[model samples]
Target: MMSVTRPYQLTDLSDLMALSATTNCADPRAAYGWLQERWGRVAPVELEPGVPAWLVMGHQEICRIVRNEQLFSRNPHNWRLYNEGAVSPDSGLGPMMFPRDNAYFADGDKHRRLRAPLDDGLAGLDKQRMSRLIRTTCAELIDRFADRGRADLVNDYAAIIPMLAIAGLFGLGPEKRHELQRGLLALFGSGSDSQAGNETVERILTEAIRERRAEPRDDLTTAFISHSNLANDYEIQQSMVLMISAGYETTKTWIAQTLRLMLTDTRFAGRVRGGRMGVDDALDDVLWRDPPMANMPARYALADCEISGQHIRRGDALILGFAAANADSRVHTEDPWLEVGNRAHLAWSAGPHSCPAHRPGRLITRIAVDTALHRLHDVILEIPADQVRVAPSPWTRCPHRLPVSFTSAGAS
Candidate 1:
């Protein structure tokens, strides 16, 4: 089938399909039918003008594609639309959809080689130290607005924790972490200037890599610099890009979504305040309902395949509809009460490409949310719950700003 292209100026945001518009990430129950009614388990969707792909929305079917790497490759080189000259190389989507030397875009032995250093780097982190860093960071962040009695949690707290923690782990100091945060925000924003931001991130990481090589440090950047598998600076830079970009955006969303649930959802609000539901429980709920990355990028089919009766042609791109899969009626129960401790959601994805930093990500989020609630007494949303706006993107769905008001009587 020939690819259909939509007409629009390259500068327009509409030129790119906005995935966040399809459903509400904060409360996905209202949007369950969006994907379910499209095509049984897999649906055809537009990925902007002239680009098309299949979105796998079923739980079991997503598992099949992710687990069976032989059939579905993660390499962007295999994408039919891009390879066939339909999607432009300079298209804003190039950063995510194009091939790179990192594990995110590689497969087989090369994938393992690029992935090992990251796994090892994260494995070596001191959990106790990380906890201290997060608590201290959260405390300081809260202190900034404690006197004001109000703050945009999304920008003031939830948004900054991950980058600070991750950057510290990567061995960057306070100033560099702020710089990294800015570059990352722009890269993930997917706005008209996203490509420029992507290039800036590369330059920042390249400099960091060069500095790390010159003077070794106890950070992830140094680990990547010394890792044997990554042969060049470009490879190391791309690997850092993968780790930082993925870690920052996903964990930020997790923090914001978890906070949203605790503040707005009565079921969780009551439990969290009364000590009936732990922060971990709230975090788990967010994973099932509003995962950090709602719709992951692409997984190209190496050859013809069929999933849930949908014909997948060779070189076709298939998106892992993780949020959709979690809500699949087949494996997921409709009742929230019964789902206590049932962590069957595909939020971290599965198979070889599953998120490796989930442990630390959870640690940062848990500390941030727990610290805020502990410090802020009688916290409440300043605006109506339904008034919160989500950022425009084809990937994750996260609250743009969570303006919250609370009493400081509980502050130490």
Candidate 2:
């Protein structure tokens, strides 16, 4: 275990905390090095006003906690603060930390049971067919704004593709598809109505569940409804909500971030000049520096344990500092350009609860970026790279808008 210079402090815990569910989430980079200098790897901190948890920044330490399900659990119900009634149910963090009936909040056998349907659903997808769908979808999205020679790539392109594709997979039509997209975007919450947005998404998904139950289709909703583990309609609805939210937000961020990287980063010049990187390289870089989910919330310590010299009490919540952990000095190098193919970053997390949709997410992102770069000539960021505004979320650090200028294909 590493030695700690100062013990974790709770003074000013209320003032120091920030909500972890918005684009406005605290930048881990700002405090990662500082925390490492003092508290070493695992540092104690407040998740919100009067809500405390450990921020695990060490790469190895995060893996240890994620993999050891017996020692640590994903169930937020185990959280001492929530269980003790310190973190109120109506808090902004409720959307993330509060318990749900889905696989995201389950543990052990229950987790496996809930997760199996999701795994089976993703596995059942035809890779070539999905790729074709993404390619066609990207082409159409590009065509919509290609003539303008400028567009908000985040909203106009990256944001729309994943939901459409995922909705198609779920056999939903245009009405439900658009509603799901709107609900999901609002669920990420730039405004004060995040809880309402959460309710909207649940209501929409519940309706979809009911519709699928009455008229079965060859889709994910059908699969969830029929899955043996999910016994009730509410369970099915929750599972669908999990699938849609997970698929939608994560992919949207991944696509937007990768596109942002390609346009702004000099290394990925998009045309392979000298050692200019490709879209896949940019994708890897995003996973390392700015993953879709910067910090995943609420893993409770099953019992008293020490991780990398930080003492964690039983039922204490630990935030998997994915962005911070990826930059851990011990495992990750200081120079980003040095390790080209190195993929040790914990972007999709580790252990049983690791992202199940990573494969499809990568495929969608790769195709979106590839098609956009090829279809649009000489794409460049409309705003200065540093000035690009991110949405207000504590967990995800996605750009709110990625406006860019490009030569029209006809002009080129």
Candidate 3:
């Protein structure tokens, strides 16, 4: 059901335009009939005349590209993206996601510098301690919501858990946790009124950064302060907000997606609840059947380079098919149409600009799903299976809301 476009099929600008217009295959494999109709192997369908960065779909090709970091990258702008009124690089959010060597943004030496603080925060006593804390947080949340099965899964469970867990990781004390959570919501939740909400977030975070810098605490905020390279309070604050916001939202989506599936698939639900499979495996199944779609928005070309026999020129914006790549049958041992194991998909992605929080995210995913399965052993999602929908962002896919009933594992 995977379709890569052929160059001959889309021979002209009109054809390319039509192809782009007609293509709405977010997770094309999610609907096989549609995939069979629209999907084809990617040809020299020119994004950049000669330098075609193969939009790999079959699991094998994605794996190959992932392993071959020298070939592809997560960096957004090697080429020019159309002008969208972005501010100058030196200004606020200018040295942001693009062209920054900070951990996820920078490659080579810059990335090494960025990884230190995260490694410190996650290393030694802290890492072990954070896991237990996450477990406790999950238990506490389940205790609070188990009796009330009508809670919103996205907000009540998935959204809140990571905030609390990360807060604890940063050693956020009682009062600070709630405040940090609010700051996070305002910044990340592009709610109905995002403009005002985001400005409020920036204002509060900048102020908080100043305060934290003045009276340095043991949290990641203070850790950023500890770093000599992160001298300016604004950059440190902005970067943290950026990383945490992206990290939080994507993780939230994955959890909600997996939990929703368990709710909808009673047999699958029983398999996890009855301890017939590991939580690791369940997480794998989640990625294959309903992976995140929030990986959209990309960078422009940096130079004219040839990839897979295609010429990619500077100034072109390229979109990678992350979800499709993960599900491609070429790399999958099982029938590509069926649910599969975690064959190490690009859910966390790979490469220098790959997600740095992959370590924490995976462990966190395991802890959350494992804890939930142990406690809420019989959650059955109430929505009709076929009618359950996946919301399409340019990148991430998340259930709108998961409604379910459950048989509690007994009062904790």
Candidate 4:
């Protein structure tokens, strides 16, 4: 392991780009490319203004980081800034980077213990039942705007379906599911309402857990409550939070990005609509070019080390650059023909903490996208693709809105 001889100075910090700012840009890849050109694979980044961390952009470099957890731990307690109290409690990064009882912030044996319930809960899911739920949810949502012939694909369709499907798996009623969806949207937004959203999510899950405990039902919530690994109510509640939030956000983004590609990219538009290329191809392509979670938060250095020639000190934070790594020339090519079925991209990430819900996530996304295209005739973007904006967040780069127009389903 190697270390920098001196601490980073204010002058050094001035040159680093704000990670959130870069992701919020319309052309983030261009900015990421500039970072790679100037700083190589590992570059200094600020999660918020003045808070420094390393953003690992190289495909191989990110692989090395994720696959070797001994050197890089998922536990945020190891983060020097957070530990030193330098990171404000009210900082926008709190909801994401702060320690939680869930598996996302755990490491080693504890991580395995916390993660078991999620895996087991997901394992208990009946894929056939889930697919049907998704299809039904999609139909109901589309029915809202299908007659109107104009829709914001993101809000009216893509964003609503995943949560409703997930809610069905948890056995939540319509009212509760919509409430959970609203809370999660705010929590993931990482804005002023994030803390309030976190509270709302916690309250909802706690109530659901209590309900499941009094009388166990054959649903994911009951499954989590009954899992041997979950020792108490708090653990069970946190696990539910992790599963629902991660699953909803990722699936929503995946559906939106895939639809965005199909409507905007000529290569996909021509083939998918003409039935020349399958929707699955477009989904895979989105995973490579614009993954649901563009930038993930994060891994902390367990010991001083060097990555791609950049010296990192012990307890330093490392943000996973999934979108940037996918764009790495070493692993990915610009040719659409070559990118269609390639699954090597780190979209689901890698290692022990890799996404547990990817299978369910994909199923939900596929059904939502397939149903939308099938029901809507000749759907086209209302605004140019280049003018489309992404929601502001330090992690996850999904379209803010995808307004599209199409033939009314009720047309004569």
Please report the candidate that would top lDDT against the real structure.
Answer: 4
Instruction: Give me candidate 3's TM-score against the actual structure.
Output: 0.75
The C-alpha TM-scores of every prediction are 0.87, 0.87, 0.75, 0.91
Q: What is the C-alpha lDDT of each candidate?
A: 0.79, 0.78, 0.57, 0.84
- Candidate 3 regions with alpha-carbon error over 4 angstroms: 1-27, 30-55, 58-77, 84-103, 107-112, 191-196, 199-218, 293-299, 306-311, 334-342, 407-409
The true-versus-predicted C-alpha distance at residue 15 of model 4, in Å, is 1.7
What's model 3's overall lDDT?
0.57
lDDT of 3 by residue, 176-221 (tens): 6666777667554545655665665566567657777689765677
Runs of candidate 4 exceeding 4 Å displacement: 1-11, 183-203, 333-340, 410-412
Error at 203, model 2, angstroms: 6.4
- When 3 and 4 are scored with TM-score, the better candidate is 4
lDDT of 1 by residue, 1-412 (tens): 1122322222233333334445445455444455455355676656766676777778898898998889999998898778778888777677667887689888888888988988998888889987888888888889989989899999998888887888778777767777777877777777787778778777777778888889998778888888888899888877877777678778889999888877778878898778887778878878988888888888999987677767778888888888888887777577977766788899999999999898999999999988988899888899888888787666778888999888772654
Clashes in candidate 4: how many? 0
lDDT of 4 by residue, 1-412 (tens): 2233333422257767888866789778997887777677788888887788888888899888888989999989999888989899988888678888789988889999989878888898888888877887888888888778899999888888887788788878778888888888788777799889889888888888889889898789999988899999888877777777678778889999888888888877788879887877778878887888888989999988888878888898999999999888888677977865678899999999999988888889889888887888888899998988887787888889999999765321
Residue pairs with clashing backbones, model 4: none
Separate clash counts for every candidate: 2, 11, 28, 0
Pick by TM-score: 2 or 3, better one = 2
Alpha-carbon lDDT of model 1? 0.79
